[model samples]
Target: MKKFTVLVLVVIMTLGVAGSAFAVETLDTNDMQQREERQSKASNRFEAMKEFNDEHDQIRVLRIERNHLQIERMEKAGVIYDLLIIAWDNNETEKLRAAREIRKENIEINREIRALHEQVRTARKEFKENVKAGDFATAQIHVDEVIKLLGEINRHNNIKVTNLDEIISVLQ
Candidate 1:
């Protein structure tokens, strides 16, 4: 009986030591791989985020450049519109001086401009009134006359400009 008990105790002690050693080995090898994989995935995610942010910033820069170009174009259009208006006015002044034999820088240019402006204002006011009165025919006539006056005053007479109205429309 005593020998049998000693043998059983020794077997239990051996199994306990062997089982603890196996567990320690498994934890070291397997858990090291799991920890390393987790770190690798985290690094990959960080790299992907950085790439996405770089693309986003590039898009913002492109949008700013586009806005700058649009602003420059609009400003240029405004300047051209103003210059064309001045040229049209000068053409009218020249026509008056030559037709009426008015002295240059002496008089009549400003007065002529005022009279012509008044004509345009009267036409426009009549057009508006006719429209409000539902007289579309009269309104159309007045508007057509206004267009004729503009054409006469602002004609370039150059084949290079086949359509002057379109230029004014776009610039305006």
Candidate 2:
């Protein structure tokens, strides 16, 4: 009985050790390296966003941080997603230079959006003042300018959206 029990224990131990060794052999270092690279890239993106001359810069940074946290919570694998990332890492970079170009475009549009917002805001204030002062003709002109400025804002927003879509295509 003792001999049989010892043989059974040795067989179990040997099988467990062999199985674990196989698992270790199959594991790769790419996952850790990819995670670190992604962290650094996100930090770079956040810094670039903070350079914007707008009140929304903080909000942009916070949104990035929030998303980063969310991504961290998810399973970030390497080889499984490598087929897609490998292609993206190579060829798709030229389209938008790996998000850098698109990011620049978005920054420029954000500046334009800010300028348009200021114009529309002051125009609205002056429009109300003119109305109160019984300057109907001037108030009507301000209204027209406000409409034109708002249209410009919308156009810039569309450009930003397109830029974002381009980034998403290359990333995913």
Best by lDDT: 2
Q: How close is candidate 1 to the true structure, as a TM-score?
A: 0.30
TM-score for each of the candidates? 0.30, 0.45
Q: Tens-digit lDDT track for model 2 on 119-155?
A: 9899879976766555656866776677677666666
* Predictions: Cα RMSD each: 25.5, 26.4
Minimal lDDT window, size 10, model 1: 155-164
The local distance difference test score of each candidate is 0.56, 0.64
Candidate 1 structure quality by residue, lDDT tens digits, 78-156 = 6656856765676755433342332232233345545655776798799667665556668667766665544433332
Tell me model 2's lDDT, rounded to 2 decimals: 0.64
In model 2, where do residues sit more than 4 Å from their true spots? 1-97
